[model samples]
Target: MTWQSHLIVMPIVLPLVTAAVLLLFDERNRRLKMAINVISVVLQIAIAIELMIMAIEKAPEPMVYLIGDWPAPFGIVLVLDRLAALMLVLTSVLGLASLSFALANWYKASPNFHTIFQLLLMGLNGAFLTGDLFNLFVFFEVMLAASYGLALHGSGVARVKAGMHYIVINLVASSLFLIGVSLIYGVTGTLNMADLAQRIPDVAAQDRMLLETGAAILGIAFLIKAGMWPLNFWLTPTYSAAAAPVAAIFAVMTKVGIYVLLRLSPLMFGISSGASYGFGNHWLYFGGMVTLTFGLIGVVASQAMGRLASYSILVSSGTLLAAIGSGNTAMTAAALFYMVSSTLTIAAFFLLIELVERGQDAAANVLAVTMEAYGDEEDEEEEEEVGTLLPATLAVLGLCFAICAILLIGLPPFSGFIAKFVILSAILNGNHIAPNTAAGIDPSSWVLVGLILLSGLSALIAMTRTGIRTFWASLEGNVPRVLVREIVPVGALLLVCLSLTFAAGPVMRYMEATAHYLHTPEQYIQSVINTPRVGGKTENGK
Candidate 1:
């Protein structure tokens, strides 16, 4: 393989290798561990960016690596395409931000923090790159195991309770995952996704029922992880109870489920599937709408900023699921843009909430009481100040909060607005609609449009209330004492969101190309299934 081709596996390998090495280090070696973790994540980000460029320019076709030079259906394979590379970059960015936040004493609070974090990233990268169902399951377990450790880190009674629920729920999902994979493999005689896709159409009629039954079970597992409503009552509480940095890194964890759906749905049940065409799209659409509604309710009802951030994750996931279900190229492209914007925005908010809420409870209580009694705290005298000065910490936190509100509420002059605008416009314009959905800007589209607008309003109201209580209406607000390391990570993440607003054109084009490739998976199928095996030999040893 060429140098560029070799980079395909580095996302998984580099993290696994780093995690193993970090395990050998003493817990007290803080300075060295910090330096190594920083360098490792930075290099991971650099590699991810390079691989994305390669996917876009050097190889639009996936770069497939056959382990041990074995044939396609028999060997373990890693495939890198535009979507996978984009996800890798997203994970690396989140990892870097979360790690920086951890360096502000969260790492020191927990033993083996660096090791577990790296292992989490290793699992995430592996899940994105792996070419088969079994390896995906393996990576899922790796990620869930590390997350179990991280979720309970800096343990408290609340943390322990939430983490237990988190652990139990995911353990059940993993069991369901195993059962589903077993059933599918039993019917298809292959664990490889591409191979399964190729053979699914030819399965015997008696077994096709079993195949879809397995697929449905698998979909339930993914939906649970994605925090779909009804199945996801555990997410908000669990995430809210996690430490700041752990919560931030978890911003990408929900996306892992969305990524699987996006990757496999089309390949496994696309137009080529005949009887199985649009198998799960209907459930995805309705379930996503319901999830979005529940998320909005939670957002409006949330009193704490952490809970708000957690619900925002559900909102983001639901939006993506609905868009994917719609199967509109333009909407899906816009959803991809929104996914990046929302994940970065929420991750920053999680970190920022820790800083902003520091030592401000007394003032927040006073403001809440004042508003409850008088309905408004400001008088004309106080409202007309011309040269009021704000504390530096308060100013920074307020600015961060404002940016987050704009992003969360889909306000103008940010990527969030741009993304939603693109999606709503696509739906209104009737470019495409999913099967069973209404035609020509029908009731379902109208319902989605109304829900999107309402969800933003709900978020806006919630953030407005929270901001006023914490920053504006408070009688004696404390200027949060934030460290440079912590603040910088939050700033960096928000700035990336800002950059997305500026670079929407190029970014949207890339997403459009990605959506195009995803909808038409023939190229991916051919690339994976027909690739030369190990030792440069074809399956027939030609």
Candidate 2:
């Protein structure tokens, strides 16, 4: 109705509209399509920033919108809180970066690269904005559908094979998502997230089990999307096979899963007897810890650059899950902080990999592919500086390693440190819980201490290896120095991480606010439940 509402909706709508516009352009006009994509992304970024300001300056409660004037519970509800706004901002910026990354390779690769990329961004924004059960499901499908197309945009054998498996797996997961929602609705009699949050707590104990069953099913679906541990088989390779831009932004695909997990963790399954496995928080932490550990080992153990970056993404993801599972409010907060950090850093990493590959014709020189593309010599040799890379190239790589090392290892002077510190402290101090409750973890203080210490060691070892190979040791491969196209996105992400490191005070304050908003959904639920201006009628307003 007002500007704020309009702004909140624009992020989703702009991308959808942009995708259609992009599609209408002559596919042969690759530059035109990319221009449209960049324009759409930049506009979306502006809208996200505006929404963030509004979110901070306006009232504390989320900005709620009911589609078609339908009452809150009966109609679809969209919410914009610090958390959602934060996500939109992060994804929008990263989306733009990825767009640029992909642009370099898209000109010759596919006619519809620009169109598909916009659609992917559209789905992600919609997924973040939708506050209804079915809406969330729809957005997930929207994103995956576009992803299925973009996943194979290059149409190579490797891309097709990996993309197909990625599709089939997510397809099954999608079906499971719908089934879970169907069951949830069959029991709770509502699809609105805010409404369900209230209703699920009140269902008859017998019927509540049905809700629990549905929630479990839904959890599995999200974990599959999040690429959590065992179900992540389809992830690394799909990413590795994708072109640079696609790979960079594709990293955010799991954000959809983590977003749902974080959203529902607070809303759908708040502090209830239904809180099992630490309300999924315990699993998140332990799973994340293992993921990080394994990822570190994978990176150290792997030679392929693409595969190595893929492993890094996995490690980044595990860090978030571990933070969540730790069951410390502060730890969860840290996980949230890390979520943003990991995404940007990894996106930068992938983009840089692409640039380096393109410039040096690494695939041509090292992998034996032939290419004089980009006017760079295939066998050109560049002088190496000891204990440092080419100034520009090494700086970018250094930034990547620095951010990843600090964040993953939970080192100090960065948001990662702040986040990990908060989580570790929360884990060690032992928050109060019900007597003899499962929430009462075993030897948590010491166990968490050990894990944190172990994580630190692993992070050190992993970073040491990577730093030695990429920066310290003479780069075995003669990749060209960073290209201008590559510099913007990677540089943008690296700078943001560095900024986060210095602005810990403000960032932590924001994170704490976000955590409070998530933990206490009373305000959110009440905002929607008490809403009555929908469908020009008084309905579902208890």
Best by lDDT: 1
Candidate models: Cα lDDT each: 0.88, 0.74
Model 2, 419-524: lDDT tens per residue?
A: 6666666665545221124665455445545655665666666666555555544334565556577677777887887788888778877887887777777888
lDDT of 2 at 361: 40
Error of 2 at 59 (Å): 4.4
Q: List the residue pairs that clash in candidate 1.
A: 69-534
lDDT of 1 at 285: 82
* Model 2 CA lDDT for position 487: 75
Total clashes, candidate 1? 1
Clash totals for all candidate models: 1, 11
Tens-digit lDDT string for candidate 1 (102-136): 99889987799998999999999999999999999
Candidate 1 runs further than 4 Å off: 362-388, 431-439, 537-542
